[model samples]
Target: MPKLKLDIASKVLRLANPLRVAGYTFETWEVIVVTLDDGARRGRGEASGIYFLGDDAANMRAAIEDVRAAVEGGLDREALRSLLPPGGARNAIDCALWELEAARSGKPVWQLAGVPQPRPVVTTFTLSADTPIEMARGAVGYVDARAIKIKLTGDLALDLQRVHAIRAARPDVWLGVDGNQGFVRDQLDALIPALVEQRVSLLEQPLARGEEAALEGLASPIPIAGDESIVSLADVTAAPSQFQIVNIKLDKCGGLTEGLLMAAEARRLGLGVMVGTMIGTSLATAPGFVLAQLCDFVDLDGATFIVEDRLPSVAYRDGTVFAGPDVWGSGRP
Candidate 1:
C-alpha cells in the first residue's frame, strides 16, 4: 500500500447576508477542507458541518486528525464508513478518496462509481427565514429560478404569511418550504392547507425527527420531504412511511459513495429524492450536484449565500448549476 499524506485546514466564509434557518442564524460559514497526496497525484474535498446539528469546524478537524494513522496507512472509502460515523469528517475524507481514485485512474469519479454522465442541474434558490415582506423581497431576486425554497421557523401564522407573500411575488416559480424540524404536529393540519392554497409544492421536515410518526396515515395537502429523519440507509427504509420525498445531504450521510447508495435505495422504495447541502463553497456543492442527477429536487444553493467561493467554483446561471472541468470530480476530461 502506498503511504498517503494528509492535510486538513479550516476556513470561514462570510455570508452575503445573515442566514436564518429554523433554529439559528449565521453570518459566516465555517468549513473544513481535506487534501490527500500520494506523491504522484493530489485530491481535495470540503465539509461544512451542520452547525444546528452540533457540528463545527474545530470538531470536524479533530475528527480528521483522529484518523491520521488510518488515512496514512491507506484508508479506502468502504473502510472509512466503519471508521468514522456519518458527518462532516467522513464526508470530507470519503470525497477525497473518490477524487484520489479518479486522478489515479484517469477517470472521472462518476465513471468510477458507474453513474451516468452529469449535466447542468436546475436547483432551488433559498429564502432564509424572515418576515413575510423580507422573504418576498428575496423571492423577487430569484424570479428566474425554476423553484425557490423558503425556510420556516414553525410560526404558523408568520410562516404561512411568508409563503403567501413569496407566492404573490413570484407566482410562476415553484415553491418549497423547509421547516427544519421546527414545527409541531398540531400545526401541520392548518399549515399544510394554507401552504397548498398558495401552491406550495413541497413541505420538508415540518416536524421534528422523533415526531415523524405523527405523519403516518395523515393526508397532507402538500408532499412532505424528510430531511432530519433520514440520515442513513436504515433511515431511508423507514422514510417512505412518513414522507413522500427524502432530502439527502452529503454532509449528513458522510459522502458521495453513501449518498449514491441512499438515493438508489430511496428510489427502489418508491420515494422521491432531493439532494441538499450545508452552506459552503462550490467544493462542497459539487459532490451534491453529482447526487442531484439522480434526484427529483436539487437544493445545492449553499454557495449562493457566500460572498466569495473557492477557485474553480461551480457556476450558477439563473438557477442552473454548471460544473466546470477545472473543478475536482467534475467527470470532465
Candidate 2:
C-alpha cells in the first residue's frame, strides 16, 4: 500500500421523519466519512458513530487523528484494529482499506471479499414507533417492501396495537419487531405472544445489554436477535446463550472485516446472522450490502429514511436493495 492522502469530514443527515424508538428519538444523524487517495486510486467509507458508547462524530475524527501518522505511514487494516477500538473510526478506515484494495486490484469488493457474484437482496423497511394507525400507514408507504421491521417501545399494549395494525394493513410482508433493549424478562414474555400472533418472525434486543442471562431457559417461538447486546466479534460468544440471531452493523462491529468474522462465528455457533445499520447514507450502507450476502436476514434501509442521500445511491427496487460499483466499492479513482 502506498502512502495515501487521508481526508475526514462529517455530514449531518436529517431524517425524513422523526425516528422514535424505545429510548431515543432521532431526527438528525452525524456520520463520519473517510476518503483515502493514493494519487491514482481512491477509496471511500462512512460510519455512523456508536452514539450509545459516546463515539460521536467529533470523537470519530479525533480517533482518526490519534493514529493519523501510522495510517498515512501505511498502516494496514489488521494493524488498524489495534490502533483504534472497534467503533466508527476503525470502521471508516477499515472499509476504506477494503475499497482501496478493490481499486488497486481492479476487482469489485464482493470479489475481493470472496463472493463470486453478488445479487440484490431483499431488505426490511422499518417504521418508527408511532400511533398504531400512523405506523400502519407507514407500512403502506413502503410500497415495494417485502419485509418490515417495526420499532416498539416497552409499552406492551401499545406495541401490540402497532403490530396488529401493521399486520392487518399488510398481511403479505414478513414482519419483525425491535425493542431496542426496552423490555425486562416478564415484559418480553408478555410481548412474545402478541408478536407471534401477528406473524412476527423475530424479536430484537428485548432485554437491555448485560441482561442476556435473564433469557436463559426461555424459549421463544420467534427467533430472538441480539443487536444492542452484541457489539463486535468479542461479544459473539454471548449470542448462542441468549439469542438465535446476531445483528451485525459495520459501525457497531467496526468494519466489514469484523462483521464478516462475527458472521462466521455466529454460523459456527449455529446462530443466525443479520446485517443491520444505523441511519446513514449509501456510502455507509454499501459495505454492509456486501456483508449481507453471508447473512440470513437483512435490514439495510437506513438511507431510505434520510431526506437527502448521495447520488449513485443504493437502490431499493422491487423490495430489494443493490448498490452498483459506482456507489463506493470500486472505480472511484
Candidate 3:
C-alpha cells in the first residue's frame, strides 16, 4: 500500500430533458468526482447518490472529507466499507480504488473482477412517466431499443392507459415496468395482471422501501426486481422473499466491491441480479457497466439521459452498452 493524494470535486450534470420518475422529477444530477493520485498513476471515480434516499452530493462530499485521512493513508476497498457506510461517498472512493488497483496491476477492471472477456450488454431504455400519447410517442422514438422500461406513477387507470399505449406502439421490444416504489400491494394484484397481459417482463420496486414485508407471500407471473428495497449486502440476503431480481447500483450499495458481493449473495439466494444506474454521466455509469457483465439484466442508460457525457465515455450501440479500457476501470487519468 502506498500513500496517495485524494482530490474531490462536485459537479452538476444537466439532464438532456426533464425526467419524470415515480417519486421525483430531475432536470440535473449532482455528482461527486474523486481522484486518487499515486504519483505516476491516477484513478478517477464519479458518483451520484440515490436522490430518493436523500443521499445527495453535498452530503457525499462531507462524508468523504470525514474519512480523508484514512483514504490518503492507503485505504483499501475492504477497509473502506467500515469507514463509510454504503452511499455516494463510499461508492466514489471504492470505485476509485478499483481503478487505481487496475492501473497498478496493469489489468482492466473486468479482468480484476474475474469476469470473462467483456462483451457489450443489452440494456433497457426507460421512458419517463407521462401521458399516454406522449409515452407512446416516446416508445416509438427509440428506434434502436430492443428492451424498454416504463416508469409508472402508481395511478391504476392512467398507468394502464400509458402501458397499453406503449405496448401498442412498440410491440416488438421487450417491456418492463418500474413503479419506483409507487404501487401498493393490492394495486399490484391488478397491475401485474395488466402488465402480464401487455407482455411486460419485469416489475421493479412496486412498493416503498420499508414495505418489503407486504410482498412476502404475494405471487406474480412477472419477475419483481428489488431496487429501493435492496441497498447494501445485508439487503441482498433479505431481498429473495420480496423480489425475484435484485438490481445492483454502485452508488446505492457503495461501489464495485460491495456490488460484486451483493451480486454473489443474490445468486446464492437464487435471486436474479440486474445492474442499474442513477441519472449521471459516463463516470457514474462506468463502474456499474463493469458490474453489468455478471447481471441477468442491465439498465446502464444513465449516461444517455444526460445532455453531454464525458469523453472516452461508454458507448451505446445496437441497444447494448460497452465501456472500453479508456472509459473507466482501466486506471487512465
Candidate 4:
C-alpha cells in the first residue's frame, strides 16, 4: 500500500436541547471526525461522547494523534484494525479507511463493507423519565411507532407504572426498557415480572457492567440484554450466565470492523445482537444502521435528538431507517 495522509478534527454536536435519560443529562454530544487522505481521495469517520466509557472529544482527538504518524506512514485499514484494539481509536481509523478505500476504488461503503443493502429498520424512541402523565403523553404521541424503548433507573414500581400507563395508552406499541445498570437484585426481580406482564420485549443492562455475575443461575422472565456489560469477546462469554442479548455500538466496540466480529460471536453463542449508537447526526447513525443488518433490534435513533442534523441525513420513514446517499468509504463525493 502507498503511504497515506491523515488529518483529524474534533467538533461538538449540540442537541437542539437537553435529553435526560435516567441518571445522565446532555445538552450536547462531543464527537471527533477523522478524515483520511490517501493522496488522491479523502474519507471521513466519527466518534461520539461516551461518558460512561470515559471517552470524550479530547481523548478521541488524542487517540487519533497517537496513531497519526503510523497511519500516515502507509498504514492501511487492515493494519489499523490489527494495530489498535476495538474502541474509539480504531473506530475513527477503520471508518476512515473504509471511506478512503471506497473513494479510491469508486464503490459504496456497503459494497466494500460487504453488508447487505440497507433495509427499513424500526428503532426505539426513548421515553425520558417524567411524570406518569407526561410520559404517557409522549408515548401517546409516538403511538404510531412500531416500538419504543423506555429509559428507567430508580423506583421500579413507579417506572413500571409509568410504562404501564404508556402501554395502556398505546395498546399496540411494542415496548423495551434500558435501566443503564441502575437495577439492583431486588429491583430486577420486581421489574422483570412487571416487564413480562407488560409484554416488554427487552431489558437492557439491568445491572452494572461488572456486576453481570449477579445474574448467574437467575432466570429472567424477559429476555435480558447486555449493553454496557459487553464490549468485547470476553463480554460475550457471559451469555449463558448473564444475558441472552448483546448491544453493539461502534463507539463502544470501535467501528464496523470489530462490530461485525462481535455480532458474529454473539450469534454463535445464540445471543441476539442489538445495534445501538450515541446521539448525533446522520453521519454517526449511518454506520450503525449498516451494522443493524445483523442485529435483531435496532436503537439508532441518535440523530432524532438533534435539533438540526446535517443535510443528507439518513432517510427515516415510519421508524425504519434508510441508508444515506453518501458512499461510506469510496471517497467523499
Candidate 5:
C-alpha cells in the first residue's frame, strides 16, 4: 500500500427553491468533498454537515486534516471509529475508504457490507414548511410520489392546515411529518389527533432532545421517529423506548460503516430504520443509498433539491432513486 494522498474542496449547491424547515431556511447547500489517492486508484466522498448541530464545511475539512497522518499511513475503517467522534468528518473519510476499497477490489459497497444487490428505492419527496396554500401546490407536483415528508414548525393551527391541504391535494401519497425538534409535549395532545386525521403514518422528532422521556409511555395514532434524539450508538440504545423509527443520516452517525451498525442495532431493538440525508448533491447521497436498502423508510431525496448534480449522478424518477453503476462505489460484484 502506497502513502494515501488526500484532497479537499468545498462547493456551494444552490437549491431550486428555498426550503424552510423548523428553525431555518436553506437556499444553498455548503458541502466539502474529499478525495483519497492510493498510488493507483482514487476514490471520492462528500459531506454537508448539520448546521444546527454546530457543524460546517470548514470544520469538517479541518477535522479531516487532523487525521491526515494516520490516513496516509493506511488507516482502516475499524480504526476510524475510535479516531473520530460521529460527524461529517468521519462520514467523508469513511465513505472515501469504502469507495477506495471498491475500486481496489472490484466489489460494490453493498456486497462488501454483506447487503443484497442494490435496487431502485421509493424515496420521500419533501415539502418545505410553507403556508397551507403553498404546501398544497407543492404536493401537486409530487402527486405521483409514493410517499411525502412534510416539514412542520410546531404551530398547531397552521401546521394542521398545511397537512390538511396537502392531504387533500395528494390523497394517494403516504404522508410523514418531521417536526425537526420544534414541538413540545403539550402540542402533541392536539397535533397527534390532527396528524392521524390527515392519515400521517410517521412522525419524526416531535419533541426536542432531552424531552424524549416525555414520550416514554405515550401512545399515538402514528409511530414516532427519532431524528435529533438519535446520533451515535448510545442514542440507539435509548431510541426503542421513545421512538418506533430511527432516522439514520450518514453524516449524523459517522458513515456507512456506523450507519449499517446503527440500522442493525435499531432492528435488534425492534425499531424501524429510516435512511435520511442532509441537503447535498448526488455524490453525498450515493453512499446513503446503500443503507436505504435495509431501511423501512428511504429519505435519500436530498439531491432532488439541488438545481444540478455531479456528473454521472444518481438517477431519480417517479420517486425512486437509481444509483447508476458508473458512479463511484455503486459497482456490483
Candidate 6:
C-alpha cells in the first residue's frame, strides 16, 4: 500500500475561562492537530497542554514541523518517533496514524485496535484548589455530581481538613483526591489515614515521579494511581510499590498509539487504568475519550473548565462523554 501524507497544524485556542491548578494557570488551551491525507480520506488527531513535559503550542508546532518533510514523503509511526522526542508532537502523529489507518480500513478506532465500543463512563468532576471555604463551596456546588476529584498541592493537613469539610458539607458525594505529586513518603502516614477516614476513593501521584522506589513495600488505605510517574510502557513495570493504577494521557505517552500500549502494559502488570487530559477545548478531550472507555476513572473534563468550546464540541451529558467515531476520526488500528 502506498503511504499517506501527513500535514500538521497547531494553534493556541484562548481559553474561555481561567483554568487553575496548583502550580499552573492556563488562560488559553494550546493544541496541535495532525491530519493524514490519502488524497481521498483524511484522519485527524488532537492534543492539549502538557506543561509537565515542557510542551506548549510553540514547541509542539515546531516538533511537528521538524518531521513534516519526512512525514509528507511517508514515514511510519516508529520512524517518526526517531525524528521527534516523545511528547505532544509524537502524540499527534501517533494518533493521526491510528485515525488514518482506521479511516482507510473502514473501522472505528476501537474496532481497529481491538478495543470494544466505549460504554457510558462516569467522569470525576474536579474541584480546583483554593481557599478552604471556597474549595468547600465548590464541592457543595457540585452537590449533585456523582463523583468529585479534588486537586491539592502538599499541605496535607490543610488539604485533608478541607476534604473533611467538603465531606461534612456533602456526605453522600463520592470523593477522590489528586495530590499531583505533592506528597512525600513520610507524609503518607498522616495523609493516607486522613484521606481514608474521609472515604476518599483514590489518591493520585502523591509523590513525585522517579521517586517510585521510595514507596516499596508500603501499603495505604486508598488506591494510589500513577499520573506523572508512568509516561511509557517501560515506566509501567519500573515501580510496583509506587502506584496501583496508571493515568494515561496522550500528551505524556507520545500519542494514542503508545498510550494504548501503555494502558495494555499497565493492565498486564496488574495496574488499574485512568484516562486523563490536559486543559483544553473539546478538540483535545475528544481523542482522549477513547481511553476513557478502558479506564476505571475518567478525568477528561479539562474543557469543562473553559468557558467556551470549539464548534461541534464533544457532548457532555450529566458527566458522560458522547462522541462518535467520525467526530475525531477513528484512528487506524
TM-score of each: 0.97, 0.98, 0.98, 0.94, 0.98, 0.91
The TM-score-based order of candidates, best leading, equals 3, 2, 5, 1, 4, 6
* Cand. 3 Cα-lDDT: 0.91
Question: Candidate 6: which pairs clash?
Answer: 91-254, 91-255, 98-331, 98-332, 99-331, 99-332, 101-332, 102-332
| Per-residue alpha-carbon lDDT of candidate 6 for residues 1-333, written as tens digits (9 for 90 to 100) | 456777767667676446556566668766778788878777776776478767887888887877777877777777766677767888888777777777778778777666678665677788877767887888777645777888887887788777888888778878899988778889988988888888999999888877888877778869888888888667887746678888888888787777787888888888888999887667677668877778888888777777667767877676577666546655433
Q: lDDT value for candidate 6?
A: 0.77
Model 2 over residues 235-256: C-alpha lDDT tens digits? 9997787899999999988999
What is candidate 1's CA lDDT for residue 59? 88
Question: What TM-score quantifies how close candidate 1 is to the native fold?
Answer: 0.97
Alpha-carbon shift of residue 22 in model 6 (angstroms): 3.2
Q: Write the per-residue lDDT of candidate 3 for residues 1-333, one digit (tens) a residue.
A: 899999999888898888998878989888999999999787888999988889998899999999999999998999999889999899999999999998998888888998776789899999999999999999999899999999999999999999999999999999999999998888987999999999999999999999999999888999999999999998987887889999999989999999999999998999999999998888888888888889999999999898889898888888899888778887444
In candidate 4, the residue pairs with backbone N, CA or C atoms under 3 Å apart (3 or more residues apart, or in different chains) clash, namely: 87-254, 98-329, 99-329, 102-329, 102-330, 103-330, 103-331
Q: State which candidate, 1 or 4, has the greater lDDT.
A: 1
Model 4 clashing-pair count: 7
lDDT of 4: 0.79
**CA shift of 329, model 3, Å:** 1.7
Clashing pairs in 3: 91-254
Task: Give Cα-based local distance difference scores for all models.
Answer: 0.88, 0.91, 0.91, 0.79, 0.89, 0.77
lDDT of 1 by residue, 1-333 (tens): 588999998999999999998778999878999998899887788998766578788889999999999998998999999999888999999998888888888888878877668888889999999899999999998756988999999988998899999999999998999998999988888998888899999999989878989999989868899988888777898887899998999888899989999999998999999999999998898888878878899998899899998888998887798766577774332
Worst 10 residues of 5 by lDDT: 324-333
What ranges in model 6 sit over 4 Å off? 1-5, 81-83, 330-333
